[model samples]
Target chain A: SQQGEEDPQALSIQEGENATMNCSYKTSINNLQWYRQNSGRGLVHLILIRSNEREKHSGRLRVTLDTSKKSSSLLITASRAADTASYFCTPGGSGAGSYQLTFGKGTKLSVIP
Target chain B: DVKVTQSSRYLVKRTGEKVFLECVQDMDHENMFWYRQDPGLGLRLIYFSYDVKMKEKGDIPEGYSVSREKKERFSLILESASTNQTSMYLCASRLAAYNEQFFGPGTRLTVL
Candidate 1:
């Protein structure tokens, strides 16, 4: 089942600017994860925010989750040209062994240098 | 490094040919997943296995089947490749209790 849905299907941002992406899910989840995918390739794990945690940060990345709203946001600071990739947010929980992550349609981000 | 390696990065086959995409993980994880990606549609799960010799169908598993004869390897098979099967296929794996799946570089299959 496709549970997560991200907003702003595509985004273009200048290098050094901050990029923000939002994701909304259908049902309750134990955690929400963010991933990055280069063109025609696999996804790289970025960050994961748990249901009990409202906010978390990793280096220049900040993630906030609101269980009430069933939404989450990922903020990237100081974006670079290499940041050009597709960003996907996945909803987790109620799946097999906690490994089933229902992914969203993803937001394609193009960072201009 | 937890590495997930796919057998082929790109493949091309006839419409009626049987196609196989293999994925191997060196981490010996207990879970493996195969997904197909289409433009504007994101990633859709085709199958997943949590143990050897066991497989489960995913959201879109109509023309696909899977094999997990070993814990470190999983294979996705297309009984009869169709043009619609032309897409990027990704393989992922993670520990049984972990949701942080590690993905392979993907196989771009083209059916003509």
Candidate 2:
């Protein structure tokens, strides 16, 4: 199973605060991607970190991958009300059974204003 | 921009009714997928197509089916809609197996 399980199923934070989420997988991966989903909208890709990469950043979002540990983390800096959304991690690779894209249960983040 | 569109934003159907949800992508991607999302279960793959008329069952494909007769279109069908089938259906398309997938707005299906 390439599924990544997100830690801290839910998180609440105040505006301007930084929130961090972690994900752990049972198997190795070629790449890992983080996504954000608003209340009822489709997922928007945030960042992708390849297995060889240690960390990647886009805007305020930072994603890190540690294949040796089969774990990943996503950090959001200076959170805002508009940043309130559910975050998910997906692990994909070139190996068989990686095409299914089994996503994690997700971490629901609530940024209070 | 990669564009993926679904046929409906919300749909209501009764049990035992045949339901059809359609998705279309403008990027002409060869890989398309269907997934169902619930409150706590995250996203579960229902089916995927690698090419026209080629479909593969995903993690959860018991009561669902998919069709890809054209390169740009994929459809998910509920043979007999059930109450348990109520979920947010998402469609995504990828240029290749390792590329990031572009998702549609999603269709919220309510089975009564």
Candidate 3:
């Protein structure tokens, strides 16, 4: 399985603090995406970074990808209580017409207000 | 807004009984996928459909099968429910392989 493995299975931080999670995969990927899931709910896509891209940001979320290391990281700055949820990293392959993604066990983040 | 709807939010079945889970997407997506999420296993793909009648097996397709008779609907079938099959099942759809997928609220199945 070329599934990505997230570091720090769980994290806790006070509101206004930064939270960072890392993911490492074993194979080359075409893109990596970050998704957030509320308790017992479907996941919502947060961001997508292509293999060629090194870094991207959206609002308080920042994503960095390193193809050389087959790793990526997600940074949430000034996280709020609402940001308490599970985060997953999905690495997509370059296969034609194959949009299948391998998801890793997510990082559970808790933001205390 | 893209919306994916599952047939049920919760289901219970007995061993040896047949079970069916339905999913429908309103986004006219060309790719649809079914996955089962377990506590420590993350999300494991069960099956996917690329077109109206084209279906493909995913990583763990042993005891599951799928049907895609229409573009908007996909169905997962468990030939005979078993205790080990209890888990949360999720349905997702995307316009293409690289596009962001929209997922439905999962169905939590309990096999007894």
Candidate 4:
């Protein structure tokens, strides 16, 4: 399975603090993508990092990928109460059938105001 | 902007009743997918259509069927709703060249 498993199934933090979540996959991937979902809402794409790239950033969110370790991490700087949500990662691959990115149980985040 | 919309944000149905969940995307994406989200199970793909009249079963396609009669519309049909089928159904669409998927608000289905 090329599924990306997120560590620390849940996390809690105070507003304005930084929150980090880790994801590890079993096999090599061409790229990796992260998504955020609010309570009872659909997921929103956060960022994507390719194999040749080590890090990418979007607004206050930063993502890093280590191909050698087959792991990726998402860092949210200065987390806000509105940032309380679940984060998910999915492995990306090449080929005609690589579009069906399967997701794993995500890391649920809680930011207290 | 890419927008995916589901028929309902919440749905309630009794066991053995037929259910239909509709999804529409305004981006004219070539790929559309249906998935069910559950606690601890993440998101499991139920079905996906690459183009009109093209459908493929995903990891968990049992008890679920899909129809893609038009480019922007994809419908998921449950022949006989069951208690185990109760879940949050999500619809997503993506361009063929991109890996990022645009998702709908999701429909929370409750089966009694």
Q: How many steric clashes between backbone atoms does each model show?
A: 0, 0, 0, 0
- Write one digit per residue (lDDT tens) for candidate 4, span A6-74: 988999999999999999998778889999999655699889899899999899999999999999999
Instruction: Report how far residue A31 has shifted in candidate 1, in Å.
Output: 0.8
Error of 3 at B82 (Å): 0.6
Tens digit of per-residue lDDT, candidate 1, span B1-88: 8999999999999999999999999998999999999987889999999899988888899999999999999999999999999999
* Reference-based lDDT, residue A40, model 1: 53
User: Could you give the candidate ranking by DockQ, starting with the highest?
Assistant: 3, 1, 2, 4
Q: For each of the candidates, what fraction of the native contacts does it recover? A: 0.74, 0.60, 0.67, 0.62
Chain A TM per prediction: 0.91, 0.94, 0.94, 0.94
lDDT by residue (tens digit), candidate 3, A1-94: 3687998899999999999999998888888889988965568889999989999999999999999999999999999999999999988888
Which residue pairs come into collision in candidate 1? none
User: Individual DockQ of the candidates?
Assistant: 0.71, 0.70, 0.73, 0.68
User: For residue B60, what is the lDDT in candidate 2?
Assistant: 93
Output the worst ten-in-a-row residue range by lDDT, candidate 1 chain B.
Answer: B92-101
Per-candidate TM-scores read: 0.95, 0.96, 0.96, 0.96
The window of 10 residues in a row where model 3 chain A has the poorest summed lDDT is A95-104
TM-score on B-chain, cand. 4: 0.98
The ten-residue window of minimal lDDT in model 4 chain B covers: B93-102
List the lowest-lDDT window of 10 residues for candidate 2 chain A: A93-102
